[model samples]
Target: MAQLEYADGIWSGIDEAGVARLEIDRPEVLNALDGAASARIIDLCGAWARERGVRVVVISGRGGAFCAGADVAGMATDAAAKGGFDESDSRAIIENGSRLVGAVRALPMPVIAAIDGPAVGIGASLAVAADLLYASARSYFLLTFVRIGLMPDGAATATFAASLGRARANSMALLGEKLCATEAFEVGLINGVIEEPEGLDAVVARAAAKLCASSPEALALTKAALDAATLTQYEAAIDREIAGQTRLLQTPEFQAAIAAFSAGSR
Candidate 1:
């Protein structure tokens, strides 16, 4: 079987059983969500969302870490070159990130985030956006937006609270706490955590199998209805997040923080 692969960033392939696998391919950078990665992921997800025979979708990372966060290095470089901020680019950035995350949340069939390691910042947003999230014991979830002087994009503020309650989500966002897999499971951020490395795939595959057996139409409808109110609220929250992110991208604090991350000083 051919493995999923992509040129710029996101990669995709269907399993023999028709499960679509979408991977963030930049292992060198911890599979960070750069502009390229975000675009590719959104496109692939949109395709899968509309395609037939793709009963399930699985997202994971190429490296051990599922995703550490957005590409701070790339963001910093772009920000600095534009004299600290380019509104046009910032709009694209926010739109791409939020849309991709929203796509995952709205995907008709089951979308599973098979997390094996750190899922921080927007990474955590992606995981929480999924209908089901499975993480390895070694995995940890973090929302490091406030730590870097940026507010949440990717509809994270809404999704996080929906999955893990307001208090825990607030702490994760505001305090930048790292919620271990066990803690995440307990708080309902993740559906479950596996201990063995192979167990991660097994658990995800089993869940996909179960989802695949169900009526796709019924599953899709149920998912939509269950998530309707929250997603409705998120529509507005996402717009606010984009506006805040755009403004923050222009601030000295975000620039310095990105610089530190890029220079390996984080």
Candidate 2:
């Protein structure tokens, strides 16, 4: 098992037991993903999927967040450099964001997401893509897309509605509210929620060990069957999101919201 050099805030390594770990470390910005980070994740996921020795994959974020969504500062800078975020720029983002989620979903082995803090916007979407999601009691999920005058991307449309139902998904996407980890557990959005502050790592470690001990063939088949049955509109939703978000990225409301976001909050 060779340790990988951290790139774009992402650190990855596969252990001797074939259990792989992917960590996102951008605590200052709450683990927000820039284009480079997104690309690195996508590339790593692809490579792991092809590596026969990799058994189970666990994803987590360092320091206080699973992920905060996209790096607004990066996007703002890129847009300013180009005068505006055109369709080309929009597609570039969609490519990285969408493919990153797709890579996670398509992993051949079991994928576990251990969320300890905030998972907002696309971050929430990405976490839900994991086959098993375990979050800490203090962790919260939010979709801030509407606040930024953009529709949810990263296949959130399907993942949220599928896990949280249409009404709850509407509550998140339209109202842009935060759903605490306990609430997410009650709503059946997450597999489990650790009540203790430091309990998340122990839970994730146990899950990974359990997955590693299980039959790989049966696990893969079960995952495929479940996804086929429930994720009926996942692909279509991704396409729709890309189309909708691209257009929204060029809208005045989105531009104004982004400009204000730089001054006030992310």
Candidate 3:
């Protein structure tokens, strides 16, 4: 496999069998994404979309954790420096994050998420955005946006509902609970769960290899059809999330929540 490094902690390469692997390489912060990393992900996905030789795409993170979520600390600092969250910052975040999710879903070939740890907030969104999701036994999914007085973005409002039904999705979003790998599999949220990271890697590799053996045209068409059927509300959900989150970000309640959360973490 030939590997290349991209900015904002992204590493990508194509294997001999035409499987492209993308890794979020920031282990220090559990692969939490800031604006630059998010933008890089969008760029990588766009590049893969144009690569005809790539039969499947595998996304994972370099650290033990897949992704903890967005860079809350960074965002808090920026907000504090700027006299709090403004409309411009909120709009940029929503636009950039939506674009990232859209890019992942737009890929013609199958996309797999090899999750080995926490996938929270927008990270959870990215995982569900993939066609297939494989998780390690230690992995968990969380949507804690409500805990910070913000709503979920990255089209999660749609993906979660489409994957796990309304009641379950509501529980996660409203309660801010952690869904472990086993529970995720039982709830039909993931394709498979393995006991170890190596096992998860092997399973994802086998699945990718199997997919590569099939007819690419057929796979692409089938994926498109399934997405059309299931993700009909995806665009609209994103739009709603952006509008709602923008207003929420400017709310006094959300600002206070962010401040308290930040202080508690310290």
Each prediction's RMSD over C-alphas, in Å, is 1.8, 1.5, 1.2
Q: Please write out the lDDT profile of model 3 over residues 1-266, one tens digit for every residue.
A: 65766677888888888898889988877898998899888888899899999999999987788988888887877777887878988888778889989999999999999999999999999999999999999999999999888899999999999999999999999999899999999999999999988898889988998999999999999999999999899999999999999988988988887777677667
- With a 3 Å backbone cut-off (N, CA, C), the pairs that clash in candidate 1 are none
Model 1 worst lDDT run, 10 consecutive residues: 1-10
Give Cα-based local distance difference scores for all models: 0.83, 0.90, 0.90
Q: Give the distance in Å from residue 64's predicted Cα in candidate 2 to where it truly belongs.
A: 1.1
Q: Among all windows of ten consecutive residues in candidate 2, which has the lowest summed lDDT?
A: 257-266
Candidate 2 residue runs with Cα over 4 Å from true position: 1-4
lDDT per residue as tens, model 1, 1-266 = 32776757877898777799987878878988887778788788888888888888999986788998888887767765776666777677778788878778768888899999899888888888888999999999888888888987788988888877888878888888889999888877789999866789889889999998899899888888888865667888898999999888767887788778767833
lDDT comparison, 1 vs 2, better candidate: 2
In order of appearance, the predictions have TM-scores of 0.94, 0.96, 0.97
Better of 1 and 3 by TM-score: 3
